[model samples]
Target: MMACAGGQPGTDAERPVLFSVVTEPIVCCPNDPDDAKTLSDVAGAKIDEVFIGSCMTNIGHFRAASKLLEGKKDMPVKLWMAPPTKMDAKQLTEEGHYGVFGAAGARMEMPGCSLCMGNQAQVKEGATVMSTSTRNFPNRLGRGLLVFSAISDGTQS
Candidate 1:
């Protein structure tokens, strides 16, 4: 049993406990040669397009990326942003992030589940993509192999 913030005390049984079975291989970041390749690796090996936004990505991440991409707009890399919601897209637009994107030679898409929904743009075969999307399973994006890494502790990085 745990004390409630303002309501009546609650018991552990009152909570809707959820559990799942592990069915996939869990590995650490790409730097682990025994595991997958890091973002720095396998990048540019054959990838031509890059995606930088998803439900996992937020305004702060966009801002940080914009700052890092300042004054450089000719890297020959295609950068795309798919805002999770219209409101988020609007907020980002109003905050001049679009301008930063433009200056950085980036593009934005309509609010949609470009990655999660699996009904939008897809990575081409034999192409590499650097994405911030959460659904990076085998061939989830397209015919090309989908690979990604995360914090060794199973936390968002």
Candidate 2:
């Protein structure tokens, strides 16, 4: 990577080659409030699976997720948590945050780029996922649209 010093940085050699093109928008959700939405329409929406992992989320995010999972029994959401680093997983496990996820029937994966790349773990087709990754590119998690969520002010998780 070159540092931009007043002028533009990358040369023709630095540019990446294109593969397949995506004509559709990365996120497919409707902007209209009249349509279904997050935390409400998606809540108890009978998602086929769920994945929660990324460098974007820290211990606080996991805690917030646990807060939301609290008191909810018989959850049909197939939850997965794959922290970006081993230390993050360790800390969460130490602080009992992982237990919260475990109690909620969420599986914990070894810290790495698991579902983010559709590599290590993959969600089923026709599933809806809420993630914490910066990009919601098509199939970034799996074969479904991704919603990037963070615990906002006065929000649960």
Candidate 3:
């Protein structure tokens, strides 16, 4: 936990504080290494699959996604949805967001590191994926995958 203090939180602080201002959404695309690209750079890009769960997502993010998916007739791409915790899944169920996700053809997974880690369910090999996972390292989610690390709203792209 971090607390606000009048001065530095610790006198031994060797690193300077830095602030990142995000005026627009960004996506971390896989390269020979990796690169952070503006969403506009990859607008209208083809995404074979999407994973919407990780430590980066919360109940609010799910709710917002549900709103976007609600009443949709068809989902063109494969969509995977998972909550970070059982409690969040329960809450979303109670709030009917789960129903919305289901109506949109989402494949729900067990909470906690579901598709975020290579150990659990993974997108098809060689598929391009937009994920809320922490990193887009090769094979982190699946073999031969071109992973893009982005926030929940990155799904809009």
Best candidate, TM-score: 3
| Cα error of candidate 1 at position 133, Å | 1.0
lDDT (tens digit, per residue) of candidate 1 on 1-157: 2212212236443323122333343322222223443345443455466676667666667676677887877868677777777887788789887788888888777776774444686666655555666656556556654434231222322
lDDT of 3 by residue, 101-132 (tens): 99999999999998888667888999999888
Candidate 3: stretches off by over 4 Å = 1-21, 31-34, 152-157
Per-prediction TM-score to the true structure, in the order listed: 0.62, 0.61, 0.80
Candidate 1: TM-score?
A: 0.62
**Among all windows of ten consecutive residues in candidate 3, which has the lowest summed lDDT?**
13-22
lDDT per residue for candidate 2 within 92-145, as digits (tens), equals 889788878877888888898887677887777657665555555666666655
Identify the runs in model 2 with alpha carbons over 4 angstroms from their true place: 1-46, 144-157
What do the candidate models score in CA lDDT, each in turn?
0.58, 0.60, 0.79
The deviation in Å at residue 27 for candidate 3 is 0.9
Error of 1 at 127 (Å): 1.0
Q: Which of the two, 1 or 2, has more lDDT? A: 2
